[model samples]
Target chain A: MEGFETIIFEKKGQLALITLNRPRVLNIYNVRMRDELYEVLSAIESDSDVHVAIIRGAGEKAFCAGADLSEFLSAPAPTFARHVRWHRDVWGLFLNLPQPVIGALHGYVFGSGIEMAMCCDIRIASEDAVFGLPEVALGFIPAAGATQTVPRAVGPGHALDLLLTGRRVGAQEALAMRLVNRVVPRNDLQVEAEKLAEKIAGYDQGAVRKLKQAVSRGLDLPVGSHP
Target chain B: MNSIVKLECDRGLAVIRLEQDPPGPGLADRLAAICDELNYNTDIRAAVITGSGPVFCGDAATAHGAQAAFSLSTPVASLNCPVIAAINGDAIGIGLELALACDIRIAAGMAHFSLPEIEGGLIPFDGATQRLPRLVGRARAIELMLTGEVITADEALRIGLVSRVVPAEDVLNVALEMGREMAGKASWALRYCKEAVYKGLDRTLAQGLQLEGDLYFLLHTTEDRVEGVKSFKEKRKPEFKGK
Candidate 1:
C-alpha cells in the first residue's frame, strides 16, 4: 500500500477498491504496475474483512490502456523475461482471488486492459467506454486468458469476430454481446460498481463463495459427467 | 417408414425424422440405435434431426421412458458427424432434451423451449441440467430449470440455447443448407476439427492446445489436406474422398 508507485489500494467497509494510478500515461500497465498489483492482490486475498473488490482506473481517459510498450518492447533476454514472468503471475493471482472481483470499466480498454477485465466475475462499463483486443493487429495474440476467456464469455463466433478483426466495441454493443453485465453513464460508473460490490458483500459470505466455486468448478466437467 | 424414426441419406447428408407424433415410449432406444448406425456410416457426412409434423416431439409416455431417454441421449453427442436439431414447434420435456443432445440447434420462430421436468418433481434427466448451463451461462440455466420457464425461440437465441431461429416453414431448409455446407468441406478436417473441439472442452487450455497442435500436424499429412492446397493453387474446387 505505502511503497506502491503505480496503484492505490483502499479498504472501505467490506469492499476493497484497487485503482490503476498511472493517469499521466492512461494507467498503462508497466512492469512496476504489475509488481505492485501482485503485491496488492496478495494482500486482498489474505484480508479476511474484505468480502468483495472493485478494480478501476484513476483517470477519466482510460482504465489501464495495456502494457507499457516502452519498457516491455525492449527485448529482455528470454531467460530474464521468463524469470520475471515466473516471479510475477499477477493475472493468475487475479483469477484465483476467493472473493468476486468487479471491474469498473471506462474510457479506452484495449489489449491487456480487456484481458484484465475478463478476469473479473462481473464487469460494469461506462457508456463512454471503448473496448478492443488489438493484439492480432500488433502481430501477436493475447497471451493472457483472452484466448479462452473471450470465447467463454461471448461465444466463439463473436470472440473470433473481435479477435480476428480487432474491431473496437462500444459499451452498448458490448452489453448486447453479454461481455459486460451493465452499462451506465460515465458519471455513475463508480457509484454503480460500488453499489454492486456492496450488495454482493451483504450476501452470506459462505453461500456466496460456495456458489462461485460450484459454478467455476462444475463448468469444467464434461456434459454427462455433471453430478 | 420405420416405426420409431425415418432416416434418409442423400449426397453425404442424412435426415433423421422422428416418425411418431409424440416420439413414443420406445423412441429413446430406437433413436439411440439409429445414432449407433450413423456413428460408423462413412457415407454420411452430416445429419439433421427434425420431426415429421408441427411439433418436433412431445412428452414421453412414462417416467421410465424419460430415464431411458437420458441414458440413450449420449449417442447423439458421440456421432462422428455433426448433428443439427431442427425444432419446428414446442420442444418441451423429453422433446427439448432430444434437441439439447444435438451439436447445433435451429429453432422455428414459433418454437418454444422449456425444461418442465421440475414441475413434475423431477430434474431434466436427459442432460439438460448439465448441457443447458454449458450452452447458456449458469445463471440463465439455473433460472430456466428452477422456474420451469418456457422461452420463445428469440429468447432461446439470445441465451445461446439455439444457434438460429428461422420461420416455421424454413427451419428444415436452413438446417439442410447448413448440413450440405458442412458436408462440402474436407471430410477429414471436418471430423478432426469436431473431434478436437468436442474433446478439448474437457481439457485445460494447455492440454487443449497440445491436442489441437497434434491434430493440425496430423491433418497436414492427410491426402485431403494436400488436395485442398492443390485445389487452391489450381483455382478449382477440390474433390475430397473423405480420406
Candidate 2:
C-alpha cells in the first residue's frame, strides 16, 4: 500500500480502506486532503484487486467537520470555483465508480462531510455520529452535490429541512430519518461496516454493480418505462 | 402573453410560464408541448418553468383532467437542456411531481408542497413513487407519500427539497439565473454528462462504465472538445456550440 500524506489508504485483502487522516481539526477537507482523496479514489477505481472500499476518519472526534473553514476563507474566486469543480469531480468518481464504497461515519459529519457520505452507496455510522449540512448558516449553500444528492437520499422535505436550517441530527435521529443505513456503537462502527462490505464483496460484483445502476438509473426513467 | 403559455427571454435565459386563468384547463398538455418545443430549439440554452399567477401549478388531475396531462417522466427525461422549476405558489400532488422532474427547483417563500395521491385513495401513478425516494430517501419519501402532508418552503429548503427559497416575485428570476449559469458551460459536455449520469444509474457498474466510455468517445470526436481544450490552454472561456 502506498503511504498517503493526508489520508491513510490501505489494502486489506480485497477491501481498500481510506481513512481521512486529520484528527485535530476533525478531519476537515483541505486542499491536500482533497487532492489525496481524488488520487486514492482513482487508485481504487482502477484497481481490480480491490473489490470494495471503506472510508472513515481517524480519531473519535469526527469523520469530517466539512471543509477546512480557514482554507475556504482564504481562497480567491477562481480558486474557489476550481475547488468546487474539484469537489464535484471527486464525489462524482465515488458515485460513478463500479465498485461499492461504504462510508463509516462517526462524530461530526457536517457540511461537505454529509455531501461526501451522500455520494457513497451505503453509509454505516457509529451511534455517536452527528450529521448535518450547516453550510447555509455559514452564509453559503451546499455547493458540492448535496443540493442535488441529499434529496435523492432522504427526500425533499427532510433534505430541505437540514439544508435550510443547518440543523444537526444524532445517529439515532439520522437512522430514523434514514440518512444512514445503520448505526452501531462507536467501537463497532468499523467492524460492522467491514462485515457489511465483506458480505457485499462475497457476492457477484457484477450483480451488485448492476443492482446499484438499476436503482440509480431506473428511478430517473419515465414511470413504468423501464427497458 | 397568451393565457396558456407565455415566453420571456433576456440575456440568453428563457422563462416559460405555464399560464391558465381561473379554472385552468389542459395546462399540463400546453406546458409539455412548450417544453418539447423549447428542447428542440437550439437557440435556447436554459429555461425556467413556472406558473403565470398565484399557482405555480394547480393539481394536474384537476386542470388537465388527470388522463390528459402529459406524463411527468417522459418530457422531463427527454429535455436535453437544464430545466428549473420556479414554484411560486402551491405545488401539490402532480404539480409537485412536475417540479421534482426538473433538474433544479426554487420555491417561493409562500410555496407549499405535498404528495396527496395516497391520501386521495390513489397511489401516485406517475413517477412520484420512484422519484420521491430518489430525491429524498425511502423513509422520508414513504412518510410524505403515505401521510400526504404539506410542507412549507422553509421546511422544504431545510430538508433539501428545493435549492433556494426566495420571495414569490424572485423565484422565477432566481431559477432563470441558475439556468443561464448552466447554459454558460460546455453545452455538449453538459448534455452528454446528464445523459450518461442518468443512464448509468440504471445499469451495472460495468454497463454504466461502457455507456460512459461510449458517450465519452462520442464527445471526444466533437468540436466542443477541441474548443474546450483550446480555451483551457488559452485561459479564456470556451464558447460551445452544443455540437
Candidate 3:
C-alpha cells in the first residue's frame, strides 16, 4: 500500500481506507491536505488490489468542517483557483472511482466536508453527524460541487431549504432525507461503513463497476434512453 | 407539447421520444395516454426517452395560460419498464421534473438545466420539489431552484443530476445502446431491483430489507434465475424468457 503523510492510508483485504488526520483543526481542508488527498485517491484508483475505499476523519470532533477558512485569507486569486482545481480533482477521483467510495461521517460535516461526502458513491454517517453548508452565511456560496451534487442527492426544495437556511441537520434527519445512506452510533460509524464496504467488495467487481457506471451515466440520459 | 410522446420498439428495446417543442404545455396529457398504452404493451423490456427537437423540454407551464399545461408526474409514475431520458436540449422547470421522474437521464453536450419555479413565485409543483432533493441533496437542489440558474451538461453529470453527457446527436444512440444492454439483463431481477430501490426509498431499513428478502425469494423461483445459474456453469448465454 502507498503511504500518505497528511492523511492515513491503509488497506485491509479488499478495502482501502483514507482517514483525514488533521483532527486538531477538526480536519479542515487546507492546501496540504487537498494535495495529499488527491495523491492518495489517485494511488487508490490505480491500485488493482483495492476493491473499495472508505473515507473518514481521524478524531471524533469532525469529519471535516469545510476548507481551511484561515488559508483562504492569505491566498491570491490565481492560487485560490489552483486550490479549487485541486479540490475538484480530488472530488472527481471520488466520484469517478471504479470501486465504490463510502464516506464514514461523524461530528461536523459542513461546507466542503459535505461536498466531499456527496462525491462519494455512498455515505454512512454517525448519529452525531451534523451537516450544513454555511458558506452563504459568510457571504460566499458553496463553490465546490455542493451547488450541483447536494440538490441531486436530496431534492430541489429540500436542497434549497438547507442552502437557504444554512441550518445544521442531524444524522437521522439526513438519512431520512436520503442525504446519507445509513446512520449509526458514533462509535459504530467505522464498523458500519466497513461492513458496507465489505459487502460491496464481495460483489462481482465488474458487475458493480458496470452498475455504478450505468446508474451514474443513466441519470443524465432521458427516461428509457441510454448512451 | 401534445406530440412529444412516440413509441418505437426494436430487438427488444423500446424508444420513447419527447418530441414537444418548448414551451412544453399540452404534452402531459399525451404522455399520460401513451403511459396507458405502454401499460398493456408487453414487447418492450427496456425503454429510451428523448426530446424531439433541439430542446428536450421547457417549462411545463408558460406565463400566458398556467392551467393549460399537463402534469408529467402522473405518466412518469405509471411507467413499468425502466425509462431513460436522452435529454437533447435544454430542460427547465417541468422539463427538469420530467427528467427526474424517469429512472435515468442522459443529456446532450449542449444541454442546460434549471428549475425556475422558485423565481416564478411558485414552487416546483411538478415533483421537482420532491424529486430533485431525492436525486441530488438538499443544499444543491435548493441552489438551482432558488437561483433559477442554468447549469451545463458536464456540471449536471458531475453533480449526479444526469447520468451521462454525450454529443448532441449521439443522445438517442446512447440511449438505445443502454436500452439494449438493459434488455439483455435478467428481466425479473431488473424489475425487482427497480421496484426495491424506488419502493424502499421511503421505508425503514428493516422494511426495505424484508422487501428485498421477499423479492429475492421470489426471484430464486423464477426460470430466469435458474437459467442464469445454469448458463454460468456452462459458460454460455442465458436466453431469458422474461418469466
Candidate 4:
C-alpha cells in the first residue's frame, strides 16, 4: 500500500479507506492506477476484517477528472493490451468488491471517474462535483463497463444523454437524477462518506453483503465483471 | 428528396427531416434508405432526425402497430452514426418510437411525448416497450405506457425521457451543434463504439469483454488505428480514412 503511486490504502478498525492519489493531474486513471487498483481491490475483497470501504480523492480540485487516454489507448500492441485486460480486469474487481464501498466524490467526475463512482453502492458528492461521460466525444468508448453500469444506476436515458452528447451534470442535477445518494458541502463530503461507511461497518458484515447481493445482483451487474 | 423524408448533408453530418405528418406511406422504405446511406457513406458521422413544422413524427393509426414500429426502429437502431432526435413538437405514437430509437433525444420546451397505444387497446409495437424501459426503467416505462399520458418536454427531461429541453426555435440548432461536435471524431470509431455499447448490452459479461477485446484487436489491422495512435503522439488530430 505504501509503495503504490496512484492510490493510498489504509485500514482503520473495520474500515478500509482508499484514496485516488494522483492529485497533480486531478487523479486521472492511468495504467499504473489500473494495476495498483487491481492489487488493492483484490486485497480488500479477501480481507474479512474490512467490513466497509470509503474511496475518495486526495485533493480539493477533483475526485478524478477522467483517464489518461494517451497512456491507455497507446498500448504497444493489441495482443498485449487484450491479455492484460483479460488477466487483470480491475474494473471487474472494483464492481464486485464484497464489502460495501462508499464513494466520496468531489470536483470533476468524468469518463472513468464517473464510471468508478457508479460502482460504489452509495455515492456522496460535494456540491462542486460534476459528472460526465465524454469519452465518445473524445473519440473513444469508455471501456470501464460504464455502458452497462450507468444505465443500471441512473437508467438509460440519463446514461445515453451523458454518453452520446457528452453533457456534464452538476452535483445537484446528479442528486435529482439519483446518481448520487447525497450532495454535501465540499468540506463535509469525505466525513459524510466515512460516517456512512462506519455505520455500515457497525452492522453485521454478513448481512450487509447479503443485502448488497440481494439488490445489486438482482439488478444485474457490470458487463466487465462476472456476477 | 422523397415525399416526406428529406435528407441534407454537410461535411459528415446528415439531417433527415420528416416533411409530413404521419410521414408518408413510403416512410418505412424512406427511413431504410436513409439508414442505408448512413451506413455506406463513411463521410457521414452524425445525423439529426426531426420533423417539419412542429412534429418530430406522427403515427398512422393503422393495424401495423407492431410492424410499423419495427420498421421505424430497426433502421435507426442499425445506423452507423450517432443520431439525435430533435423533437420540435408533439412526438406521439409511432412518432415517440422513432424518437426512442435515436441514440440521443432533444426536445423543444413546449413539445409533448407519449406512447399512447395502450390507451387505444394496443401495446407499443415498435421499440418503445423495450427501448423506453431501457431508457427510463421498468416501472416508469410501465406507468407511462399504462397511463398513456402525454408529458411535456421538461417532464420528459425530469424522467430521463429526453436529455435536453430548449426553446422551439433553438432545438434544431442545438442538436446540430452537438451532432457536429460528435461528427468530428473518427467515423469508424463512432460506429464501433455504438456497436460495442449496443450489442454489449445484450451480451453476457464474459462475452461482452470478448467482443470488446476482439474489436480492439480487429482495429489493429486497420490503418486508422495506426493513424489514431500516431496523431496522439504527434499532438494533432487524426486524419481517419474510415478504412
Candidate 5:
C-alpha cells in the first residue's frame, strides 16, 4: 500500500516493476530488502492482473553488489535467525513466482546478485554489468541459491570455475557463460527489459504461465519419467 | 606412507601421487587411508591426485578378484575437500574412473582417456558407469565405452570431462594452484558447495531445492561465516579459520 524502505514496487497495465532502491550502497541485499522482496514477490504471485515482473536496481553503480554481509552475519539467536531466513525465503520466492520474471541487470552483480539473476526466467544485462560470485574469497560459500541456480544456468564446469576461483566476469563473459540471455548498451537496459516484460504481459496469461511451467517443470522431471 | 602412494602436505593442501608404475595390490587401502587422513587432517583443505611418471594408475584397477577392493573412485570421492585430478598421462579403464571421481580435473596436454575395460570382457567396476554418464551425458558416455575410443585431452575438455588442459609439465602446477586457491577460502563452505551440487543433482527438483536450502541455513551457524561478513565490512581479506 505504502512505500518500502528498500524496494520500489509499482504496477502498470498487467506489468510489475520491482526496483532495488538502496542505491547508496549499490543495492546490497539486506534484511529490509529481503522482507520487502518477499512481500513484493508474494504480491505478484497472488495478483491475477500482474502478468509479468521486471526487477532492476535504482543506481548507476550496480544492480546489486551482493548481500549486505554485515547484516547477514550478525544474528539475534541461531534458531531464530535460521527460522527467519526460512520464513523470508527470498530465493525460493524468486524461483516459485508464477509470472515469468526478467532481470534487467547492470553494474556489479556479485554473489547473491548472480543467484538472483539466475532465478529469473530471462536476464538482460547492460554492457557495463560485471558479474561474480566472490563468496569463496570472503571465506563462505554462496548461501543463496547460486550453487544450484548457477550450474543450471551456466552448466557445472563454468559454474564450478566461477564459484571456486571467485573470479569476476564482464557482461560479455557472463553472456558467453549463458548466465545472461541478452546484452545491451547500459542506457538501453531498462528499455529492453521493459520491452520483453511488456511483450510477455500482453500474451494470453494462461498460455504464458503454461509455457513457463512446461519448460521449468520439464527440466525437473527424471530422464525416463516423461518420454 | 607407502611407496605405491606418495603423499605430501603443505599449507592446507594434500598432494597424493600414484607412484607405483604397475599399481601393486592393496592400492585401494592405501588410497582409502589417505582419504581418511585428508578427512581428519583439518589443516589440509584440498587435495590433488596425480601420477608421478607417465600413466596415472596403470591397468589392474578392476582386475577380477581384487576389482571390488581396488575401486579408485570410492576413496577419492569420499574426500571431504575439493579434489582435483591432475591427469598427467593416459587415464584409461579404471584410471579414468579415478579422474571422474574428482570434483575438478586439469589434464596434461599429452593425456588420453578411455573406458576400454570392455575389451577385457568387463564393465568398468569403479564409479565410471555412473559418473561418466553424469559428466558427459548418457549418449557420449555410452559412445566412448561402446567404441572403446580413446579421446585426447582437448577432446576430454570438449566433452566436459576435464575443466582445463595444460602442457604435460603444467598439469600438476595448474591443479595444485586450483587446489590451493580453494584451500585458502572457507573450507567448510567449499565442502558445503560440493555437497549441494553432488547430492542435489540426483534428487528431484523439489528435493534438490530443499537440500540446497538446508545447507545454506547451516552455514549461518559457522564462525567463519561471521568472519567473512566482518572482514567484508572492514574492507580487508577475511581470515578464514578453516585454513
Candidate 6:
C-alpha cells in the first residue's frame, strides 16, 4: 500500500477496498495505473486479514473508460511492449486472488474497464452503467482476459455479439446476459456492494474460497468429469 | 417403419412428430431411428420435432431406463443439422430429456417442464444432469432436479430453459416457420456454426477459439461461402445448395 498512487487501498475489518483514484481522467487505465494495480493486488493476495476485496472507481462518471491512448499509442516498440506486458501479469493476478473480488461498477465500463470487471468473482452494476469492448473497433482485440472470461460468463453468442459489434450494453441487459451478478439503482450501488461484501466476509472464508476454487476449476473440466 | 415416430421431409426442412397416443416402450427405439434418418438425409437442412397428443409423452416409456435413455439421446446431441423442439405440453422424465437434446426449444404457453425422476429416487439418467447446468448453471439445475419442481412456460423462458414460447396450437407451425427460415441459410455455414458451438462446449477457451477459426476457414473453401459473398456484392439472396 506504500507505493500506491493511481489507486487507493484501505482495509475496514476483513474487507479490503481498492478504488481507482483517477477520477480526473475517468480512471483511464494507463501505464501507472497498471503498475500500481499489480502491486496492490499482490499485497491483497498475501494479506490473510483481507477476506474480501471490492474494486470500484472514485467519483460518479466511470468505473474506467479504457486504456490511456496517450500512453499506449506511443509505447516503445511491439517487442518491448510485449515484454512489458509479460513482466506484469496483472490480469492473471486478479484472477488468481484467493479472496473473492467484487466489482462495484457504474457509468463507463468499456474495453479494459469491462475486462477488469469480468475478472471479479461477482459484479454489481449501477443502473446507469454501460459496458462494451471497443478494442475490435480500434483495429486490435481485447488483449486482456475479456476474450476468455466474457464468454465464460455470457456464453459465446453474447460474447461474440459484444466483441464483434463493439456495441454498448446497459446494466439491465448486462444482468440479463449474466455479465453482472445483479443491477441496482445508481444511488444504491455503494450500499448494495458493501452489503454483499460484508455478507461474503461473514461466511467461513475457508469454505467460501474452496467453493470458488471448485467452481472456477470445475468449469474447465469436460462435461461429465466434474466430481 | 414405426408409426409412432413420423418423418416428413420437404424442401430443406424435416419434421419429426412423435404420435404415440399413450407412448409405448418402443418410443425410445423410434426416436433413435428418427435420429438416424435425419443424419443420413443430407438434403435436409434443419428439423422441427414435436410430439402429437395432449401431452408430449404422458410419461416416456423408460424401458430399461438409464442406459437405454442415454443411448437414445446420444444421436440427438450429435445431429449435424440443428433440431428445434416444439414442446406442445408437459415434458417430464424422458420426455424432457428429448426436448433438452435439441438445439433450441419453443414451448407452448400451456406447457410445463419437470425432471421428476428424483421423486422416484432416480436421477436424470439422460443428459439433463449435464445439459441443464450448461444451459442454466449449477445452482438452478441443482434446485430443479433436487426439488423436482414443475416450472411453467414463462418460468422456463426466464431461466433460459426454452428460447421462446407460443400458443399451444402454434407450436408446430411456429417451429416450422423458424426451421424454414434457418434452413434457407448457407447450409455449409449452418452446419459448421452448430458444430463449433456444440464441440466448443467440451474445449478450453483457447482450444474452442482455435476450433472456431479452423471451421470458419473451412467454410471459406465451400461453394456456398463463395455464393454468399457473391450474393452480398450483387444485392441478392444467395441460393445455397449445401455444397
Sliding window of 10 residues with minimal summed lDDT for model 3 chain B: B204-213
CAPRI category for model 1: incorrect
Candidate 6 stretches with Cα past 4 Å from truth are A1-151, A154-174, A179-218, A221-227, B21-25, B61-71
- DockQ of each model vs. true complex: 0.05, 0.09, 0.03, 0.39, 0.47, 0.07
Candidate 1: tens digits of C-alpha lDDT, residues B1-243: 366787888899889888776655466667778888987788787888998777887666244543443443577778877677899888887788778777778899999988877787778776778777766778999999999899999998888788678999999999898788667656656565556555655676445444544554455455665565556446687777667
Model 3 per-residue lDDT tens digits across residues B1-243 = 435567777866777777666634456677777777776766556677777877888775555335644688668766776677889899987888888887778799999999877675777778887788777766788899889889999899777788668999999888787678667656556555556556655554234434544554556455665565556446687677776
For DockQ, candidate 2 versus 4, the one ahead is: 4
Better of 3 and 4 by lDDT: 4
TM-score of chain B of each: 0.93, 0.87, 0.93, 0.90, 0.94, 0.93
Best by DockQ: 5
Q: Tens digits of per-residue lDDT for model 2 on A27-132? A: 9888788788888888898887888899999987999999876654344544445545544477668777778889999999998899789878899999889998
- Docking quality of model 4: it rates as acceptable
DockQ of 4: 0.39
Among incorrect, acceptable, medium and high, the docking class of model 6 is incorrect
Query: Which of 1 and 5 is the better model by lDDT?
Result: 5
Model 2 share of native interface contacts: 0.06
- Candidate by candidate, in order, the iRMS in Å equals 9.5, 11.2, 20.2, 3.1, 2.2, 9.1
TM values, all candidates: 0.58, 0.58, 0.54, 0.91, 0.88, 0.60
Query: Candidate 1 clashing pairs?
Result: none
Give the chain A TM-score for each candidate. Answer: 0.95, 0.92, 0.92, 0.94, 0.95, 0.96
**Highest lDDT model number:** 5
Tell me the tens digit of each residue's lDDT in model 6 across B1-243. Answer: 468788888888988888874455576677777778788878888888888876765444344444444334576776787788899988876778777787788899999988887776788876889878877777988999999899999998787778678999999898898788767766656665566655767777445545555565455455665565556446686777777
- The Cα RMSD across the true interface for model 1 is 9.5
Name the lDDT value of residue B170 in candidate 3.
92
Which model, 3 or 6, shows the larger lDDT?
6
TM-score, cand. 2? 0.58
